[model samples]
Target chain A: MRIYIYRRFERFWHWMQALLVMLLMLTGFEVHGSYTFFGYENAVHYHQIFAIAYLILVVFAIFWHLVTGEWRQYLPTLQNIRAQLDYYLFGIFRNAPHPTRKTALSKLNPLQRIVYFGFKVLVIPVMGLSGILYLFYRYPQQYETLPFGFVGIKSIAYWHTAGAFVLVAFLIAHLYLITTGTTIFSNLKAMITGYEEVTDHHPTSDSQKQEEVVI
Target chain B: MKRIFLGLLLLGIFAAILIPSLFKEPYRPPLLSQLREKYHKKASKSADHSKFLPLQKPFTRPQEVTEACISCHNQRHIEVMKSSHWNWERLEYVTGKGIRAIGKKNILNNFCIGIASNEAACNKCHIGFGFKDASFDFQNPLNVDCLSCHDLSNTYLKASGGAGMPDPSVNLNIVAQSVGRPTRNNCGTCHFFGGGGNNVKHGDLEMALFDTEREIDVHMGTDGVDLSCVDCHTAKNHQMLGKVYSLSSMNRDRVQCEQCHTDKPHQQTILNRHGIKVACQTCHIPTYAKVNPTKMEWDWSTAGNLKNGEPYEEKDSLGMVAYTSLKGTFTWARNVKPEYLWFNGTATHVLLGEPINPTQVVKINELFGSYRDPEAKIIPVKIHRAVQPYDKKYNYLVQPKTYSVTKGDSGFWNDFDWQKAIQAGMQHLGLPYSGDYGFVKTEMTWPINHMVAPKSQALSCVECHSRENSRLAALTDFYLPARDRNYWIDHIGKGLIIFTIIAVILHTLLRIYHSTKNQARRDV
Candidate 1:
């Protein structure tokens, strides 16, 4: 059976965010002088531009999540969490069944919920706030910057770079987890077409089975 | 609905970048009117002294002009006497005692040491007449030099050691008639040439200031504002507005940018906020000694070195005098980036009789301020380093007679005898100088406040925040990000991150082994 897992708005937000985040990391690391690709000045310029766009996307995505009642999909639970962890670790390698089923109401498994929840609630907010502060730290007007605040530029830069590394680590892990689906391309295809396949004899309700064709 | 939100966001981003321009064009009065008012006010206030019958005489002595000027302006001579230019002694308050009088006359500087035995050569910049020896009259009002401050003819040439009077060949009648308001040339004559020649003392101030472009100095640009010396430094009763490092006056509020500008001089709020702790000069004057090279290092120990039977000199790549047998060895540089420091108006001077530490480099004049001081701001400075003669036996810096070229004079340059020069200098100052002398390392600091570049040329954010070759690399008081790193914290953080990944991988391998056994049993 095939099931519609992600809405159009959700798919749009996901792909746009991924693209912007990649662009931000590229330009941001250049600004940090990690390895210069675009020159330092150009890197800073592009990073600021992408950051503003990412902020706009975040606001719209937040609104969409709230209106569609999709925020609950990330609400974590301990029930079957260990089973899910076992499935990812031991069960999948031994050709065992997945611990939890995917539905319109539950897009993420237990561990996914915890990781994504922390990213959205903690890491993303931290990155956004710190990036904003760094942008305006030397807000130049009439060729002079505003005096420094209580927090120095160094503190702001450290927090922003730390957040970026967290995001980078999450991205690497997210990439690896995509290949652990029913088929290597199954999760990727679902994100693109909004339809994910299930085993033929999977015990899904008639109403739940019919939900795949709605989109 | 989503499309509408995206459209609104795009509009907001555009507004964010565009709104600043609308508020940027600040309302400044037309520069034409400001210039006219400034020059007109200065020109109209001075009574035409040229028409006065008392001044129309062939003055043989420069003192006669002073005498004639004081005849009409009775209290002018009295006011001039109290100024640092005339007295060469400032009311020292940096130590907070306020009782001591300290100035160039008594301060032991790195460039030329002290003015004790070298008064004839040093006092070419002095503002009086016939101050040849200790018995020179300070109370005589006729000795006040009016022409040095108000020479409009620009032809008045003060012979280097001619006791504060212009050379006899320079017609005093013409000079007396041409006296008017002080221009840049009038003040820069001594200031730009201090420590010997142009670009010697203050790196930011040089002959380049006379007709430099806007890129060199925005305020004093020849093609732009063309401001004279009196424009910002408006004098009242012969006392100039700005304080000098040599004078060590704490009256910093006498003149500032606030005279013509508002506190909120920026269009952006953040820049205005930065204005509180960062001085205007910090950003504006990015580099000093832009056009002409300024002397940075002077090694007096190398003086009296001769290649053969005659004195020899060496030149650097830029043709600047590098070494000379007469004086010392010097190193010069142009477009030099100034060292940053925390400066709170006051500069501490090492007085003439102060004790010396031979083991360490002595600061001839130390500029004191720190990040913790509220009154202090980060400012740019030119650090002039040197090796000078000091009395090793007395544990004090020695003053050597430098430029008395007379046959019988005991000047070091006149006849290369350190003992005679030291004896002559000690006798003149009436201070004890032990016969033994040795070279001691010394440094002098001058705060850079001129040669302001345009706004576009100001330092960028990354200049001072980089890992290598950062402008503030030498600054150790506070840790700067990107430039400074805590190794332990970084290592520990990375170690935890690595440990987490390793633990995850190990736990998964163990789970796989257990699950394979269970699957094998189920299949059997």
Candidate 2:
């Protein structure tokens, strides 16, 4: 039975962030001199545009998460984390059932919650801060007064590049994990349409328990 | 609902990408050129010099003309006498080497060596009368050849090998009467012909800049702004506002681009930021010696090679002197790309009698700065390399007497003998020279400050930002994007990405195989 899981705003934010991150990576790597795609100047220009868009999206998403109390979705828990790891490591090949169940109230598995929490608090913030420093490395003194007193862009650039690599790795793993749902396209469909088909057996009791725990 | 979100996302992406590119960059006013025009108009002299009775008198000697100039403008020679142009040396505070008097008189160069024993010939451009030897009095006001610089007449010529005297053929009275503001012709008389030939020493400064078009030089172009040499090199108390790093040490009196154009001259904020670290000449003067070829190499070791016991000259296909039996072999290049380095406007010169490593290429003058120096900017320079004589035993460069007024003298060109030339030169300077001498490689750098092309010819970002053949490839002290990257991060990052892809593929296959096996079992 299909049930509403991701809200309208949540789905929109997810897709938009995905598109912006992809664009940032494409242009950012080009600016890094990894390869010539958009040309150096154009790549820097587009990268800055995408970065600003992403920052705006982040501000809105942070506000939305706080107001709607969807921030709890990324609150990490140890419950069934070992089982989640086991499921990916050994159980899935043996046709074993998933260790943690997903519901409207507790939408993420223990492992997903931890990974997503870290990605939100750690990886994204690091990327954002380093990128901001890099962008304003040498702003015109006439236009804006920046407090940053960085001697060189060496460390900031390296950290930003390293964060980009990590983000790309996470993206590849996340894309693969989408196929690990009950059906191959189920999670993908869920993200797109704001719904997922949950098995009907004891759904009311499971959701009630999840709601209590989440609250 | 999904379709609406997808369409909106696509539209937003397209708009974001297209909006910036669609709008052209705002037009920036040509403020620099406008300022140049203003200065060019202001450079006009108020007084017609020919009307003065003192200048109209018949003058036989160049010194007599100086006496005539001081007769009216009495105190002007005081300012002229105090200048480095009169003394040919200045007291400079060299880094690590305490306050030392350094200039063309004492400094060693890779080119025609030094002026100690070759003054009679070399002092043809010295801006004084009778600077033939060490005995020339610096205190004499009449010795100051004011007509060399102040002469508006094109006919004022310094006699070759006459020790800075005006040529006898030049009508001194005419030159004296025509004395006014110096033109491109006046400055180019000495500067354009450095190292005994046109465009030989400084590759960027050549005869071509005297009346060239905007393509060759924007500032000195007669058809353009028509600015004289004194426009940028503004003089106060006869001390000009510029320093040649080859002859100067301190950061003072530099004629910066910011003197006319502000530090933030570019339209884009990014380019303005770049201006802090990159000099204007680094981008604007992309290539120098645009018209005439300049000497790149001079090998004095191959000198004394006589063709039928007579010094003969050989020319290349371009008619540039390739070899002369008197001065040895030379290589010339036109439209040469400049090498880049960080300079904070200070320099350290290799003075005479200084010990040098004979095996290594000696830097006659080393420009001081690095990437970490906040005051430093990357500047383009033309490095003139040469193989010149040095004392093999004492390990010091030997100054050779390369010229003489009369034949059969001890000068290198006259006698074609290095021993006699070195002996005469060292004895003149009162320095010890080992009887034995051998040629050692040396280098001298001339900062390219002229022949600025039109704005459109400025180097684009990719020219120095790319991985291969970057103009700043030699300057590897700091990390430059596109030109530099961390090796381990790149390799490991790529490795992890590939490893993750392979693992994902393997995991997917395993899951598929297991699921298919279970389905087959259920069907059976």
Scored by lDDT, model 2 comes in at 0.86
lDDT of 1 by residue, A155-197 (tens): 7877787777777667766776786778879999999998899
Q: Estimate each model's TM-score.
A: 0.85, 0.92
- Predicted structure with the largest TM-score when compared to the true one: 2
Count of clashes, each model? 6, 0
**Candidate 1 at A160: error in angstroms?**
3.1
Taking the tens digit of each residue's C-alpha lDDT, what string does model 1 give over B107-218?
7777877788787778878898877777778899988899988888888888878767677778888888888878888899988888888988899889988777777887
How would you class the docking of model 1? incorrect
Q: Clashes in model 1: which pairs?
A: A145-B271, A146-B270, A146-B271, A146-B274, A147-B273, A147-B274
Model 2 lDDT tens row, A119-208: 999999999999999988972232344577544688888888888998898899999999898788999999999778776434666665
- Per-model DockQ against the true two-chain complex: 0.17, 0.41
Off by over 4 Å in 2: A94-97, A139-151, A201-215, B1-27, B31-44
10 residues in a row with least lDDT, candidate 1 chain B? B36-45
Distance from true location, Cα of B505 in model 1, Å: 12
lDDT of 1 at B315: 96
